[model samples]
Target: MKEADRCCGSAGSFSIIHHDLSMKVLERKISNIVTAKAEVVATSCPTCTMQLSYGLKSHGLTGQVMHPVQLLAKSY
Candidate 1:
C-alpha cells in the first residue's frame, strides 16, 4: 500500500491497448503490495481488480484482489 494513490495503469481499456506500458506501471503497484505483505488487495475499480489480479499471478504471488464492497460484505 505504499503508493496506494498511484494508478494501477488499467484505466479501463488502457491495459489491453497499451499492454507493455500498463505492465510497467503495474509492476510498481505489485512491488508495493509485496512490500506491504498483502494477502488481499481491495479496490473499488473493476479494472484495477483485474489488473492487480493479473499482476499478482504474473509475479508468482499468491495474493487475491477484490472490490472494497466484497471485503465489506465478507465481514458481515
Candidate 2:
C-alpha cells in the first residue's frame, strides 16, 4: 500500500464552525494513521490535508504531507 491515505475529518466549513469537534475527529484519525506506521500522508482536499498536517505536527509525528497529485507526480 502507499505510505499514506487521505484523512477524512469532515473538512470544509464544518471544521471552521466546529473547531473542537473537528479536532476530536482529527485526533482519532491521526491515531489510526500513526498506528499504521505510515511515513507520508496525502489528501485531495486542501482543508483536510492542512488539518491532518497540523495534527501530525502537533503530535510530533515524523511524517511528510503532500497532495495526492503531488505524490503521484513524484512517483513518476
| Alpha-carbon RMSD to native, per candidate | 1.0, 3.1
- Compose the digit string of candidate 2's lDDT tens values, residues 1-76: 2223534566688888988888888878888778888888777778877888888899999887788789999999
lDDT of 1 at 61: 96
What does candidate 1's lDDT look like per residue over 1-76, in tens digits? 7988999989999888998999999999999999999999999888998899999999899999988888899989
Q: Which runs of model 2 end up more than 4 angstroms from their true locations? A: 1-7
Q: What would the TM-score be for candidate 2 when compared with the true structure?
A: 0.81
| Highest lDDT model number | 1
Q: How many backbone clashes does candidate 2 have?
A: 0
Local distance difference test, each candidate: 0.92, 0.78
Q: What local lDDT does model 2 show for residue 23?
A: 83
TM-score of each: 0.91, 0.81
